[model samples]
Target chain A: MTDIIVGILAFLGTIFVFLAAVGMVRMPDTYLRISVTTKAATLGIGLLLIAGAIYSNELAITAKILAIILFLLLTAPVSAHLIGRTSYFSGVKLWKNSVMDDMEGKYDTSSEELRSGFETDPEKSKPTKSSG
Target chain B: MVDRIIALDLIITTGIGFISAYSILYDQPALLDVAMILALIAFLGTVAFTYYIQQKNKQ
Candidate 1:
């Protein structure tokens, strides 16, 4: 029974990881590709890791598997964010076919004061007309 | 940048593929676990990085 279960999980995991690769290549944009691949890989690997843990029946190994799962969940988004933000700053062009400009609209017309979040709080930043 | 990242992915995947192949051949569950996890991590990290670069490019 355990062997069957392990085989099923391993097979499922392989399919998922393979899908991630396909998505990475097939998607037109970076974010979309990343989303597909990252999400798939996480679930796939997590399952496979757990399968391995179950097979090993070792508490330590299972814990490590769980740790890796948790770690992946936490860092995946952050790294993707970094890459996207950096690409934008360094001037990677947006997909011409993209319909919206959610990130750009904010920066396009934004003045320095607006950008700094002090547009309505000049008094708070002033040395005070009474003092300076 | 994609080139650099792809190069890295290829290298890591090659290394990991070797390790995974070894585990499968030798029937080492522990080694298999390690390979599977590392491969997953690399796959995710690269995909994520690619997204970020794209997002940044958009910005």
Candidate 2:
């Protein structure tokens, strides 16, 4: 029974990781690649770790596996965010077919700051300020 | 722009994860430590690469 469960988990984990790899290649832009790969890879890693823990059937190994899973879960998002931010700052262009860019013109490259969409238009804010 | 859409570190990390699981199934627990360290280094490597890219573009 344990073997069956472990095999199932390992298979599922492999499938997810494989999907991440495929997405990485198929995605058109850097941001899209990062977004797809990070979530899938992280989940795959967690599943693989869980399977390993079950297969080992040792308390110490299981604890270590859990720790690894926890660490990966915490850092995956942070690293992905860092990569995407850096790519944007480095002027990686978006997909040509991308419809709307929420961050367009909202990022102040000079100061390395990101402003809200509403805050980006001084003209829009000026009318409200004058009315108030 | 990088030639590849995805970063190399992500692929390496996934491979290490798979290897670690295989190691456990094969009755070699020691390899798990190595896999964990490799994964850690892969993540740090990605962060460092991004920082480098950011600094390069800052100019």
Candidate 3:
């Protein structure tokens, strides 16, 4: 029974990882590629780790697997966000067919700040001027 | 250029980590350590690359 569970999990994990690779190749732009791969790869590895933990059934191995899963889950989003932000700031263009860019005109290139799109009054959102 | 390179590096590192998970099937648990370290390196690498890009843009 345990063997069957492990096989199923490992199979699913492999499939997701494979799909992540395909998405990385097929996605239209850098941002789209990053978004797809990060989520898919993270989940794939996490499931694989869980399967390993179950198969091993050792205290040390299971704990290590848990730690790895936690680390992957926590870091994947952060890395994806960093990559996307850097790509955007460095002027990587969006796909031609992209309908709407929520980040459009929101980034202040001079100060490297992003103004809030939700705020109606732009001046009210600014930090108080430092000095004259 | 940098974006594509970094994204590709991330995916490849992830693939390597996934492969290391296979050690468990063969009853070699030590390789899990490799997977753990790879995860750390991938995150640090992304952070460093992003910082480099940001600084480059600031100049």
Docking class of 3: medium
Lowest-lDDT window of 10 residues in candidate 3 chain A?
Answer: A123-132
C-alpha displacement of A120 in model 3, angstroms? Answer: 8.1
TM-score of each: 0.64, 0.86, 0.85
Top candidate on lDDT is: 3
- Pairs that clash in candidate 2: none
- Compare candidates 1 and 3 on TM-score and give the better one: 3
Which of candidates 1 and 3 reaches a greater lDDT?
3
Residue B37, model 2, lDDT: 85
Ranking by TM-score: 2, 3, 1
**DockQ of every predicted complex:** 0.18, 0.60, 0.62
Give lDDT for model 1. Answer: 0.58
Tens-digit lDDT string for candidate 1 (B1-59): 75346445534444443453344445575775666577577757676777776555454
B27 in model 2: Cα distance from truth in Å?
1.1
Please give the distance, in angstroms, between residue B9's alpha carbon in candidate 2 and its true position after superposition. Answer: 2.2
What is the per-residue lDDT of model 3 for residues A1-132, given as tens digits with 9 covering 90 to 100?
999999888888888888888888788888888877888888788888888889898999899889988988888888888888788878888888988787777676667677666677878465432211
Q: List runs of model 2 lying over 4 Å from the truth.
A: A108-114, A117-132, B1-5
> Is candidate 1 or 3 superior in DockQ?
3
Best by DockQ: 3
**DockQ leaderboard ranking:** 3, 2, 1
Reference-based lDDT, residue B33, model 1: 61
Candidate 2 is graded, for docking, as medium
